[model samples]
Target chain A: MLTNRRTLLAGAGALAAGRAFAQGTGAPIRIGLLHDLSGPFAGAGSVPLSVGAEIAIELFNERGGVDGRMVQAVAADSQSRAEVAINEAERLVSQERVDVIVGVYSSAHAVPLAQRMQAQGKILWINSAIASAVLKGKHFTHVFRPTVHSDQYGEGSIEFLAEHCERATRIAPTQFKLGIIYEDGPYGVGVATALEENARRVGMPVALKEGYSATAPDLSTLVTKLRRARPDAVLQVGYNPDITLFLRQAKAGGLRTRMLIGHGAGYSQIDRLTETFGAEIDHFCNVDPAATQMLDPSRLTPPARELQQTLLTRYHARTQSNDPPTHASMGFNNTWVFLEHVLKPAVREGGGSIDAMRRAALGVDIPVGGTIQGYGVKFNPPEHEMAGQNGRSVAVVMQFENARSKVVWPTPIAGGPPVMPLPAGSPFALR
Target chain B: MDPFLLEAIVNGILLGGVFALPVLGLNLVFGVVDVVWLCYAELVMVGMYCVWFLYTQAGWPLIAAFAACLPVVAGLGLLLHQLVVRPLLSSPPITQVLATGGVLFILQGGAMLIFGTDFRSLGVEMPPMEVGEIFVSGTKLIAFVAALVGAGLLWTFLKFTYVGTAIRAIARDREVMPLMGVDPRRIYLVASAIGGTLAGLAACLLVVQLDVHPFIGLSFGPITFMICVMGGLGNMLGGFLAAFLMGVIISTGGFWWNTEMSYVVAFACFIVVMFARPRGLFAR
Candidate 1:
């Protein structure tokens, strides 16, 4: 009896020690992914982003996660509400105890959530929100964004226009009259402000600038205004419904423009637009991060090419979409960067402390064509105006032809020359 | 007038046409049943989804799908009346309103469960028609003409048919209509079905112009209610006229200022009208 009791005690002691060892070394790294998975933003690239982030984490874990510790993702829906996003972020930090939080789809939600996460001193890696105000002049140490910003979208559109205006439209860049219209939200306002500023810097004349509610039932009056202004090209920023309304109204009002350029959001869903407007939107140009699927594999690093292939294959299997939207690449590439570059090294250095994570993030330096999206990874230092922003991240202008997007700007990466002034067959084309 | 301003006015009238059917439906239900179906717009949303499913998914012809939408929505209206509104007919107006509000959430949640949040478009567009200096959307013009025809048919039914006369009588005097050998319950059900049919008609028109999502109703719902109130709650003609007036105001406001401000101007106009009339613009 004495011998049996002693043996039981020994077994219990061994089990306790083994559990402690597992807790200390083999525990999974918890990442909180906050995105609008079930709200209005879901269809506007949020779902793709969530799916992409999940895929990246899955791939990382399959390859034997950060330094032998598996990575886990805790996803919370923002419901497209800023308050909900903040509350969920707080829960993920205080309750779920996530080491890093990533993936916010809307700038409106990102603005407040970033501030909250920064105050809490928790690391927040932004995957998709693009408003320049999200990082501009806010030298945040804990927040890092590795995707194109709204200012890039603004500048990219103008640059594309300036470079290709004379050649394609027979209109000088200086004489080009640009019309700016946008939904009066943070994303739209940010892009519109940047577009106006960049256009002014380039000495391009802006014919009309208008802001409308995204939920407005009628855009006919705005269409009438556009008709009156008759701008050489119209730059619009809006989500799905408003863009559709504007296009429908523009067609009805015969609001002719030399070209119609859109910045991300609704514009990225070229297939949906094509399904609606058919050939009318064939040459419509959209400024956004290049979908990695559209980029030439030869230009990307060997690893990046493989990653792109895997992402596309998995994404297509999941979404049944042949052409993966740009958001998927942004989500996958940014989360992959965080996991491989920042989290892995941080854990290796010292138990994945927030400070160590910060150091690892700052130390990341990759040249162009290194990532799946063909953008490099180099966060602006904390001392910089837009600290924690990926300064090297770029946006490209892509034209939709036959419901497929082809990059047409930034000469180095462009698949083909832009079709400017639209084709004569388009109703919006200049006669 | 500037041609642009003229264009805005014309566009406003066209927008008015879009608002007319929904306003008439709401007014019709309020007139006969005396219970506000706050879920009216949601019913329209469901009708839109039905049409989209039949036409796009089930591979039915567009016109056939549209024809099927009317009866499907009318049956839904009958079910709603039988299931929800009927039980609450004896309750206070506030209670009825709350019940229908609950139904609104149910419908929205159900749609979310089924269709998800993806915006589904019918992907049908008609070319613009040029009328001198004014350009008009072919889709909007068709919707406008259909709304007028629907309104005319409704007026004809009310004036000529025995059942329609009974519905009118119930709206006129709910207490006395029972004494006049007309069953108020049957009349209410008929009015509700007709209201649903109008909503379905509006849905058919709207699906072509705008993409249909679950929350698409919120875009035009509030304005519709305001139009109903402005025209006098039970007065169909007043609601019809008010829809156009509101449409012109909103469109012209958009013309003068911007789209967001235009809605503000519209609501402000509604407040001013309410302050002056109290009951409605055409209570008598």
Candidate 2:
């Protein structure tokens, strides 16, 4: 027993010694967070993403730093332009010599930056942005994304609904009137295809469809057209304002339906839309991963849970604001995932040069936020898609209810039953 | 297909009346000034953003927001003409194109820096108008009627007003117009100013229908420029006619191919039209 106690103490001592580097170092080791601070996505995409990313870097330092080196995040706002994204990425690499770069808001910005990542030999950590094309090629050799791709969002939505209906016997597969009311764009098109295919596999027929321009002056015409089809559910697609326009039009039209689901626009600048629509959005549905659910008080992994809570508490304390729903939590997890899984291990084995770190970043196994959804992340060499079964695990069916959105579908992580008998003929419902 | 195609065409023509504000004024400038006035397309963009800035930010009423867009954007037009157009007036056509191109950049840049490229849409407080499953917007109908009336008023001014005739006279004979009691500079100013004001009005109407963004101006600029050139460099009738043709092509292409390609199809058709009838649909 004495020997065992001594061994345990020695082990504790060894672990303490081991944590000096893992705890973060005395000197700062740089990570770069480049984002659109003053451009289109600034409100939801740029500021919140950057703030969340910053909190993560701050948390790393407070934990004795990553590998005993203070994890410093040097940030630059790309202004949501491609040239600016490339320029800031170059600056981060040359001036700061950052180990990782996080928070790009547009696919237009990400595709080119991915190419830059390959050439510079650096790790690109992607969180939330919808440019489906980013997952198409292996150009960004040093990048790893933990979020679901655009295509999978639709597929996941269909799958979730199918699984739910099968359990509840609400709608038979044959009569499932799946419909799509989508923005006419590439990302929208990809999602549309995913939904159609997935719905078909579940034996549901996509009955009604319309592709409207996001730039349309008013969505009334589209809403009227969508109403004509009288679909069971409509998959309303677009970015922030598209969602807003559809919701407002649906409300004014007094259209009701079984379910109303927005495309994966839940984590966007949805606050504006919520403010405008008021309680009307309570019945609305949107697709965003249950990232925070994984960080719940009960289920956090040893190091990860502590890290999650520390960052959440410290961030709220410093900002004097509530911890962002999943915004900061994703950033914090993404940063830690990049460092703990890729950077530190590479440095221990291969000296953590830019090339070494890039190589290691490729081999990461991403697990979903256990408290959120069960998406454990893994990537295959030359396989660029950041989604499939594991990625789908965390996709919680979310509804905006009572002035706040919560996971309301696929129990186990769900807070409440879906508000069934959703407002009749919901223009934004996905069939 | 239920003769809805015919109605779509009729409504498409009616829609052209509203869109003519940009085509007519844009071509008017091109006819006399020989500059494309790329920024003219963005005049509507400026108007929309200004309205959005007022309504959403300053909490102004929609009508007030619409009212404020005109004067502010009119001043913007005057500044653009004075600072940008005047500097490049004597240079080659390429230089003139580049100068007006700079205007597009400045306006778009200002919008981006201020607004950060998020979308801004407006509520008209009216439901969509439908005639037996033919879905159309109440806001769009109003814009069309307003556009038709505005276009007619401009047409009357061109035919009857002294300054308008002088402006027309200058378009016909730029160098010799001074003998006809027309100051080329004043005519140019009036043309650009009128063009700018119309663009601002269109901008307000557009925001009520769709969201506004700086990048959206880039999307609008090239197409309107094409409309002017494809219709005929300086001919209003030609500009008006080709506007519908291009719109139909876009609506069809957006259905058949892809959204981004709507611009490409219109531009490509412009190229094809230029190849078949190099002078455009109407002879200048």
Candidate 3:
């Protein structure tokens, strides 16, 4: 009888607290933008990513923010340091009391931030960190990755290579010798492991697999080895500067292959690559999660095109360049989805409670064509190991044609057919 | 010998020649000033940015940009010596190292702010020179020839010119040279200026082949320092020989394995040689 009375009192106290929160007593919803603003990653990633998130916030406010309550964002720079990211994350949560968190550009920064968000039961929407380990188990339920992981690139490349090689060279997949050169990092290892598995499954011969540090001074030796192997195809996993170095050295060292596929970290930013290498960068290909905003007009829905234009304009305004960094598109899409489908719904119903936000996010199921990237957002089954992964995420292959890059694989979305037999050759040839 | 091995050797030698100029400058500054400029690599980075800005952005001729890089960087070097190096000259060696390290940060950060971290290249392409079975990059060959010419001129100047003679005397003993009517401070500033000019020349050579970014120095810095140490910290000839030896070792190792393993092999060679002769490769 005494226990029943205590339970009744506890329930009444909760109801009173809810009533107070509902009656204009609570503060506006706060979202924290955690990104690397100053370190090594700041240039290629953080600045544009920050702008992408801010654009999303700006767009939301223009539309009368979530359920008539103001949404404020607290921004913190990670300084491209993992330790700094941890400290900044703590400050964002403890002092700022952020309702949601977004933005991470590298696995080094993302891994720790994911753990914290999971522990705190707060949400972290990942934009660019592609390491598969981030979504490995049940521990990452609070982390949602709309961007495709590293493994997807491997599978996508193999699929595209199989078709392109058979159609162009009339060579069976089994006869093709593959060479892999990758940076010795989480991102590279993850993609390489997947590429190896997929290659084995498809009965392709693996001739060489070499790993080098990202900051390696020269790639002449690796290129020489690859030249000796003379593989039908080569897969490179690296960042911007190393990609530039490797390509230049490979050409200078006289290393040639039938096809060179880059698992897009720096390669996806084709404008920068082109500006650095010019016409010499032609015939290179990269596989990444499709950013339909930058794709051919026919591939995008009307709404996506509008959103893309808005994002492009905002990015151009900030960078004073016609080209937008790839990260900016990703940043805008991820943040836009969270605000439109998750935070707004939760705020409308539950006075911006974290639990309510999580529920709303889990229930979100935007169709493939609905998103700006032309891919839907639906979390994988809760029972699966990849429960945090966006199930609709698929990889797309992009190839450099002349100076500009265009999507060339997955026929429905391809801007053009794949450029095969890497050295200058006909579009339709069997050699 | 295998053709591939022969080509690798040739490439290594050429690379060593390119590396020699910057290392030579580093050795000169160390010999005379007794100060290790940790920001030496960053100075090269700034020079590269200047080349990019002058040639690519401002549409200056490549030759003009190359010429401008020298004095511009020499001015920067003099300014640095005046502000940072001279102030802490009498302090402990660690203080000098720390101050130089601060300059490195400033240069790197300042470059990023000014250049915006976008990778810029000169887009200067020259057809590879085919020699027998191997193809040699024309740009690298030019860099090698330029290095040889620069080294020759520097050697000639030191032997023939009065100012250069005084600079050399000061290197022998800064305090003792004062009795010989040489101002050590003026010699130190000249040495720093010469060092900067050499770095600028290296930047012009490298900018053609490599992308220009704030972090470009890091790729060459540690290895250049290693070569300087292995060649004898202050001996110019020793440093050049050590650079070629390191280059050949690195190239051969790279051919046999990967860049990382090649670096390990080069480091191992340096460690062994340093132990065998504490004074360095050309120890008198």
Candidate 4:
């Protein structure tokens, strides 16, 4: 009970020791990883995407994590449903108390989830979900997407057509008749609208535009419509099931086009399409952010190149997929950028507060070819029209040749010239 | 008529042919067993998986795979009867519906565990045939012919064979047939097996057109039930006719409007039909 100097000194020393220990190894940073782990989108690319994000977190943690604070990923399955994604995201933020949330596979889910996160003032780092509407005009200070948007996808395909239509198909760009067909979902609608608008801007004639439910039992009627319209090239936007159904019906209904371009989603599953259609999809092109593995190693920065290799090796080991879908690269690259660039600096500056993270994100200005996807990182300012969107993300046009994806557009980074009019023997090819 | 409109009508008829098998199967099960196998489309999904496994994974010829699918699905139907439906036959109708709905989830989860969610296609397509101003899908044509053959064979069986006649009699009057020395239970089991065999046939046709996935049953299942109910739930001929009618409406709707709007039109037509005939179009 006596107030002795020796006892007081001992108590103070113990308190100091505990505080020092806490300061040296701070509390683990919790990241909520929301993605469609089951249901229809799981097979589409969501599973691999979530796995890729997990690998990034695991790798980061292995390297002692940001500022000696281990990153903990609280994974939740959206199940390819918007309601589920919103609920899971709410639980992740309110119950699990994650510092940041990342990885939304479907644009339909992301649109609502992003709004909910923005309203709640929680940070959301989107690794996928390419709908331009997610972050187009309504600038959310906390929501950021580093991936190419639907506008980029639409523009890339049109630009490729404009540049090479005459050389490949012997048709001038102005005379080429383009047809657009899409599933009537947020993702499909977003891309189709972009395609139509961009096509008109380039003076390209659109022969037909049709929207159908992705779950429609038969697409034969749509195929027949396409046949009647007689478009020189067709641009399709759909998920896995609808894409397969459309192709099958198109083949069966004798719908022929000089060329076909698919915008991401189902188009990224080259292996599955090949399994179903064999050489039929040989010249089918897709517009998406470059799959990290598809890029030349020399183009990426040294650190990014190493990260790319690590991601591919771990991804193949995890998924047993020799061909990594673009979604996987998106998951790994975007998450890595958030960790190495945003979270690390934010933690050092202000103990990783939400505001600190936002400042760090906006402050990022990586130049071209800085990331594994060969895209730079620079978020548009809050005052900008497309706030929270990555200003430097790029989309490339890639064509499938013998079940392998080869980048064929944006000549500087392209692996080869676009195969126009599709080589003979493709079922959809013009004779 | 516009050539494109004609093509749309032809495609609609072919689409109706695709819907016919499932409608007939559901009608048979509902008519004879007097219990709705809400998992009927799930049965077809399983059959699809079976055919896909046999042809693609096990390296069986497509025909052999189809042959194996029928018996496998038939056995599954018998198992459904023995394990699920039979136990709840004496329970309320609502209880039976719940049980079958549970089976739907079980089958879906089981398929998901076994096959994952990847959409698997049979990867078989036949070239399109050009008929004077229209293009006909070779695969749909084959499926249409096969469906007609399946319906005829089923019709012949019902009209000629003793078991089939007993089954029909039981469907007509469950109490009267038992009084006439027909065992309704035995007839129900045979009807379930026949229903499953029809589902297998439907699976064979659908696999060539649509990719097979665990949740694929959701795509066409509701429409199949709609067709069955529209035609008078237990009326096989009514269901057959209704399938064609609905198919034409959908195809023509799509031709006139857009793909998404066509479904809207079909659903609207269905609502109107239901309101006009609550007991169904051919209830008597």
- When summed lDDT is taken over every stretch of 10 residues in candidate 3 chain A, the lowest stretch is A1-10
User: Which of candidates 1 and 3 is the stronger one according to TM-score?
Assistant: 1
Per-candidate DockQ versus the true complex?
A: 0.40, 0.10, 0.27, 0.39
Tens-digit lDDT string for candidate 2 (A1-431): 01111222233233334443455446555667776665444543455555566665555555555456765556676865679889999998888777678777656677778777867767777766554666565535566676666666776678667766544436776676766877665556666767777888878777666665554433443444445456667777675455665666564444445666776543334455554555656666777565463335455455556665676676566444432555555556666666666667777778767777756766666554432234565654555344211243355567776656677655666776766546433343333
lDDT by candidate, in order shown? 0.87, 0.64, 0.78, 0.87
Error of 4 at B115 (Å): 1.0
Ranking by DockQ: 1, 4, 3, 2
Please give the C-alpha DockQ score of model 3: 0.27
At residue A325, what lDDT does model 1 achieve?
82
Give the DockQ of candidate 1.
Answer: 0.40
- How would you order the candidates by TM-score, starting with the best? 4, 1, 3, 2
Quote the TM-score that chain A achieves in each candidate.
0.93, 0.80, 0.88, 0.93
Candidate 1 C-alpha lDDT tens digits along A1-431: 01121222233233223333354348767788887765567767777787788778778776777656777677787877799999999999999898689899999989998898899999999998899898899999999999989999889999999998989778898999999999888899999999999999999999899998887888999989888888999999988788988998898789888789999988887656766788889889999999998899999999999999999999887677767788888889999999899998998996799999999999999889899999898999989999999989989999988878999988887887888778789988867
Recovery fraction of native interface contacts for candidate 1: 0.70
- Report the number of clashing residue pairs per model: 0, 41, 0, 0
Residue ranges of candidate 4 with Cα displaced over 4 Å: A1-26
Which is better, 1 or 3, measured by lDDT?
1
Model 2 TM: 0.82
Q: What does the lDDT come to for candidate 4?
A: 0.87
Docking class of 3: acceptable
- TM-score of each model, in listed order: 0.93, 0.82, 0.90, 0.94
Q: Cα miss at B46, model 2 (Å)?
A: 2.5
